[model samples]
Structure formats: C-alpha cells, structure tokens
Target: MEVKRMTDREIVFRLLRYEQANLRNYQNYLAYTKNKDLSAYIARTIPQIEGNIKSLNVLSRKLCGG
Candidate 1:
C-alpha cells in the first residue's frame, strides 16, 4: 500500500468538492427528515457548510488566479 501526499491546491480543491457534496446531502436530509429537532439541526448546520464552501471557492479562485 502506498500513500500519496496532496499539494495545497489539490487539498483545497478536494475540500471544496467535499463541502459541496456535503451541502447537497444535508439539503436532501433536511427535505426528507420528519423530525423537527433534526431538521432544525440540519438547517443550522447548512449555513456553516455553505460558508465553508464559499470560503473554499474563494481560496480556489485565489490559487487559480481566476
């Protein structure tokens, strides 16, 4: 088994992708969950995930010079 190290840019891109997927999953869960408490928790968590995605996008742009 071999372990590969990722560059900073690659790591940022991976983080951005992961956050995007997580945001989508959270939204799906929020829509389908019937429990009010869980829904509220998901709602609260969504903003933080969105913020992370936004920040990662900014970082990506900075790295790529777009």
Candidate 2:
C-alpha cells in the first residue's frame, strides 16, 4: 500500500472547515440551551472557535503564497 502525504495548506483548510462547523453547532446549542451557565459557556466558546478559524485562514494564506 502506498501512503499519501498532505500539504500544510490542505491541512489548514481541513482544520478551518472543522472549526467553522463546530462554531455553527455551538451556536445552535447555545440558542436551544435554557441553563444560564451553559449558555454563557457556549457563547464564550463560540468566539474562541472563530478566533481559531481566523488564525487558520491567516496560516492557509501564507501557505498558499498569498
């Protein structure tokens, strides 16, 4: 069997997609949650996820020679 190698740009793109999906899921969960503490936690986490995506995008651009 042959192994396939991944590039830094490809990896960052996949990570960006994953982080975006998680952010969406967290937003939906926050909307449905009734517990104040949990909702607060989820809301706060959403920004962190966004920050991760932002950082990944910057990395991806650099990897792509943009």
Candidate 3:
C-alpha cells in the first residue's frame, strides 16, 4: 500500500475541517448532557476545542498566503 503526501495547505484545510466538526459535536454534547460533572468537563473542553479550531484557521490562512 502507498500513501500520498499532502501539501501544507491541504493538511491545514483538512485539520481545520475536522476540528470544526469535533467542536460542533462537543457543543451538542454540552447541550444534551444532564450530569453536572459531565457538563463541566465538556464546558472546559469546549474552549480547548475552540482554541484548536482557531489555531488551525490561522495555519490555513498562512498556508494560503492570506
């Protein structure tokens, strides 16, 4: 089997897309969970997830020469 290498732009775009999806999932979990501890944990994680998305967006912009 062979793997294809991705360009920096491609990599950043894929990562940004994936992180955005994960952030949405986390937001949904936070909205639906009833347990207090679980809610707290998810709330804490949401900021980290948002940070990741922000970082990825920056990288994507840089890669695209924006």
Candidate 4:
C-alpha cells in the first residue's frame, strides 16, 4: 500500500471535525452530570472547546480560501 499525506488544509479540517465532536460529547455529558464540581469543570472546558472549534474553523477557512 502506498502511503498518503495530508495537506495543512486537510489536517485543519480534520481537527475541526474532532473538536466539533468533542463539543457535542462534552455537552451531552454535562447535561447528565449531577455533581456540582464535575459539572462546573465540564462547563468551564466547554468555553475552551468552543474556542478551539472556532479557531479551527477560522484556520480551516483561511487555508481553504473561504
């Protein structure tokens, strides 16, 4: 099998997808979490996750000429 390489744009798109999934999963978990401390921690990370997704989206768009 030949090895395949990913371009910077492709890599950024992949990371963007992963971060989107992470945000969805984290939000879902946060909904079910009952503990105050755990919920607070998860809530805090949500903003960071959102930021990552936002940044990744911007990077992906820039690389793709969007």
Highest TM-score model number: 2
lDDT of 1 by residue, 1-66 (tens): 999989889999999989999999999999999999999999999999999999998999898989
Q: Where does model 2 exceed 4 Å of error?
A: none
Candidate 1: residue 11 lDDT (0-100): 96
Query: In order, what lDDT does every prediction score?
Result: 0.95, 0.93, 0.90, 0.92
Q: Can you write out model 3's per-residue Cα lDDT over 1-66, one digit (the tens) per residue?
A: 899998988888888889899999999999999999999999999999899989988887787788
Better of 1 and 4 by lDDT: 1
Tell me the lDDT of model 3 at 1: 88
The sequence of per-residue lDDT tens digits that candidate 2 reaches over residues 1-64 is 9999998778899999999999989999998999999999998899999999999989988998
Relative to the unseen true structure, what is the C-alpha lDDT of residue 66 in candidate 3, on a scale of 0 to 100? 89
Q: Count the backbone clashes (under 3 Å) in each candidate.
A: 0, 0, 0, 0
Among all candidates shown, the one with the greatest lDDT: 1
Residue clash pairs of candidate 3: none
Instruction: For candidate 3, give the lDDT.
Output: 0.90
| Best-to-worst ranking by lDDT | 1, 2, 4, 3
Tens-digit per-residue lDDT, 1-66, candidate 4 = 998999998898889889999999999999999999999999999999999998998887788788
Q: Which residue pairs clash in candidate 2? A: none
RMSD of 2: 0.8
